[model samples]
Target chain A: MTAALEFREIDVSFGGTFALHKVSVGVHEGGWLGVVGPNGAGKSTLLRTVAGAVRYGGSVLVDGEAIDGRSQRERARLVSYVPQRPVYPQGMAVFDYVLLGRTPYLGTLASESHEDIEDVWEALEALRLTDFAGRDVATLSGGETQRVSLARVLAQRAPIVVLDEATASLDVAAQHSVLELIDRLRAERGMTVISAIHDLTAAAQFCERIALIDDGRVVAEGTPGEVLTESLLGEVFEPSIRVIDVDGSTVIVSLRVEEDPS
Target chain B: MNAGRPSSTRLRWWWVGGAALVLAGSLVAGVMVGPIRIPPIEILGTLINKAPFVTIDTAISDRTEAILWEIRMPRVVLAVLVGSMLSAAGAGYQGVFRNPLADPYLLGAGAGAGLGATIAIAYGPATSGWFIDPLPLAAFVGAIGGVALAYLLGYTVRSGRTAVTLILAGVAVAAFLTAIQTFLQQRQSETLREVYGWILGSLNTAGWEEVELVAPYVLVCLFAIFIGRRLLDVLAVGDTEAGTLGVRPGRIRLVIVVFATLGTAAVVSVSGLIGFVGIIVPHTVRLLTSSSYRVVVPLSILLGGAFLVLADIVARVAMTPAEIPIGVVTAMIGAPFFAVILRTSKAVVS
Candidate 1:
């Protein structure tokens, strides 16, 4: 299978600080890849690089075409990114905000057509947000807002999706609903999904492959069984934890507290 | 949900309808309620049949006709045009910056224009006779000069800049220019009263020539902003997001800033600094139209015009023979409403 998105020796810096350094990864078409790291470990930076939000000192090829020369709109046509927490303008109805995802496809100052409205409706329906279409985004609960953000990405209809902690703000039920929605989208649409996730257990359950990033570098990349071992988790996360297989599923649970006297 | 669409449309129409009714009523009231107090019917008759070519005598005297046509009519017209320009410029500025607090005066344009006007008032009379009479011309030149200087300063910060730095620089420049204006006002005591009156702002002395001078510039600015309303929508989202949506956000912002400044300068030139109309009208319109520039811009223009006409009417009639400054009336009305809005509305940064 051809790689849907590939990053070769990517290095990104902000001001003088390095966000991501010499990182290389390839996501095959229809692949579900999870990026797990500690806070400030450049996971979001990696996703932003793929989304073409930041310029990097390396090559990013989408479907064998070099993306360096393509405009942001061209990249958006291929890859839709969902930020962790999307800030929306007040008084914007959920339906209108979702319709903004279709901006890239709109022609020359034209209003959204019936087809565009239908696409928005479809996205809302898929996220079970049909009832909330007319509701103000400012009035939405945290989880509902996150789902609305996802619905916007769905509306874009891009083949590749980059989600930076897309479900972090959601409650437990909403988190499961969002993850299940992503699973359904991947299976139905054959989309390549790359997400920066915080929950290792959820990552183990959902992702086909996991890439462990630490200090702006990917330290491990493999199947969940290979990458979610005790040593790798310990080294990358700096957490005193034990990885256990419960009902044939890997789970990470905190063990004992370590106190250091200075 | 589909039912909501029709209701939204109806609500929008109702707003427009209500504003139109108020505007028409205000126009009648404004014409009839001057010191001479011409009846509405006589005023209308005079307007229709009292053109240069045709003469039909009405209840109103010839002096009253001159007062209505040559004095009050032009002043009212100037007020409406300047009001529309300021409000539209405010709406455009708010959209481009993605901040409700943003106004057309955000880039030192007003202060620059203020300086230019002050300078012209000080120097023009000594050099030329014709230039000494109208203060708005000097103000207009100053307004443009101020905005140009602000843009130059802002451009020096970076090749492509954001709204925050531009606004900060404007604050600094405005403060600096205001200090100089204060110093000049103090030195010229005889002209100090005139400068003070100018700063307070009034449409009391405007006539046909001033109206004709300002109308075209305001109209052109309004037309340009109306045509670019769609691009303004893209800008409501942040620059990066707008860029991803195929717009060069930096270029769009530059164009909007220039046009908004031009519109603002044109209005300020005619009316001096009519406080709070620019900031308050746009915010009010946003609440009514839900921040869609397509709706907000046009609505702001109509409502803004009505607001100023009403204010100018109050200025003319409230004190009877001695007129109150139009700026004083607007500030008194706008400041309280602005406070209420700030207190009541949930703060959304963008």
Candidate 2:
């Protein structure tokens, strides 16, 4: 089967420094692919390239079609991205913010239709954010805000959802809940999910496959059991890393490298 | 499930209707409540008679009629036009900048116009028979030029960092232009009163000619902004998010800034640097109603019209005959009101 989303030799550079250098990756339909990387490892840049938020060389294809020449509105219909730090304007209502997801579908001169409003309501309901609809977005808690961001992307109704460390700001419990919600939604909708998650354990648990990137290159790409090993993570992370299977659950921890007795 | 959230369509009508009613009331009051007291009923009748295919005969002297038609009506209409124009532009600036305090004048338009008016007053022909006066023409060119210069400077610095660079460039440009204006004013001491008068702003000279000059630009800009309001809402989320949502923030902002600057320059050319209407009106609308550009943009147009008309009424009446410049009235009112908004509404200021 053809991959739902594919990035081919994507190269993104900012101010003479390569953020992503000739990175190629793909995720099949209904598959959750987690991208794990060290700091400044080009994960966000790769995701941003797919979201068309960054200028890059090489092609990003959706279902066997190159999207470079497609209009932004057309691309938006295929992929919805939730950035690492979502901007929820202080005065905007949660409903209005989510309703913005329908922008690609609406004409410049047209107002939101009944169906658009219904879709927003559906997304809100699915996220259990119906109660927060009228509240100012600034007033939402971090987890709630993350959920609201997800709700906005969900309302976009794109076939592929790309999240760049969406749970980075959330607490541990909230992170799992948010990922679980996304997993359940992806399963129900059969959507392709590509998320750059910082926590390896959570990524292993939620994502079907994992891509470990270091220094603008994917060093390993396989199922959690294959890609995440003690030796590989230790090499990439610099700190002494340990991966242990606790009752069939992958738990990754980084131990402080003891001062080498020089 | 959505009860707390007011139905947008129904609430929109109420907001629009209420604002429109206030604007109508303010316009009528503006025409009627002048130094020459004409009965409100008679003024209404005279207004009705002016409408196409309508006639309402009331005992009214030729002097009152002249005052109503030539003097008060034109001024009132110009106030509405300038008020609405400034508010629309202000809201657009605030949206694009994502700064609540951003106004139409934030981009050096006011300072450029001030310099232009100063140059015209200091050196240009004092009187002319030309269809369009040289002062407004010069000011229009200067305002657009100032914004263009700022944008170019911003682009040159870093094309990607426009929002911050543009604002900084605008400040630099405005300060430079203002310095030139001050030096020119000091050199031409005779034109000091005239230049200051223009800078302080007024609608006292507003006639049918001035009204005709600015209406089309105002209408065009308002129409463009009306269509782009939703995109403006998307822009409030910042560039990356807006781009991800398929709206090109740079393009949309450029379009909005162009139209807004055009409208603002047109009005400022005629009315001078009317302070605070741009800041006060849209902020007021956002406070009382919703912050959604869909609501803020249109309601700002109406409420701004009403706000300025009311302020112009105070400008005309408070000192009586001496005629305080409309800008003074707006500042006197706007400063306190804006402070109150900042203090009271954390959502807006934030």
The 10-residue segment of model 1 chain A with minimum total lDDT is A106-115
lDDT of 1 by residue, B159-268 (tens): 44667777776787888888887787677767776776777788876888878877888898898777677677767667766665556777777887788888888778
Supply candidate 2's per-residue lDDT for B313. 94
Best by TM-score: 2
List model 2 lDDT by residue over B1-350, tens digit each: 55455443224677888998999999888988887788888787778888999987789888888899999999999999999999999999999988887888888898899999999889998566665579999899989988998888877895465688889999999999999989999999998999999988899899999999999999999999988888888898998998889887878888999999999999999999998898888887777777888888999999889999999999999987788988999999888987887678645543
Q: Say which docking band candidate 2 falls in.
A: medium
lDDT of 2: 0.88
Positional deviation of residue A10's Cα in model 2 after best superposition, in angstroms? 1.2
C-alpha positional error of residue A63 in candidate 1 after TM-score superposition, expressed in Å: 1.2
Clashes per model (N, Cα, C within 3 A): 2, 0
In candidate 2, list every pair of residues with a backbone clash.
none
In model 1, how many backbone clashes occur? 2
- For model 1, report DockQ: 0.37
**What TM-scores do the predictions have?**
0.91, 0.96
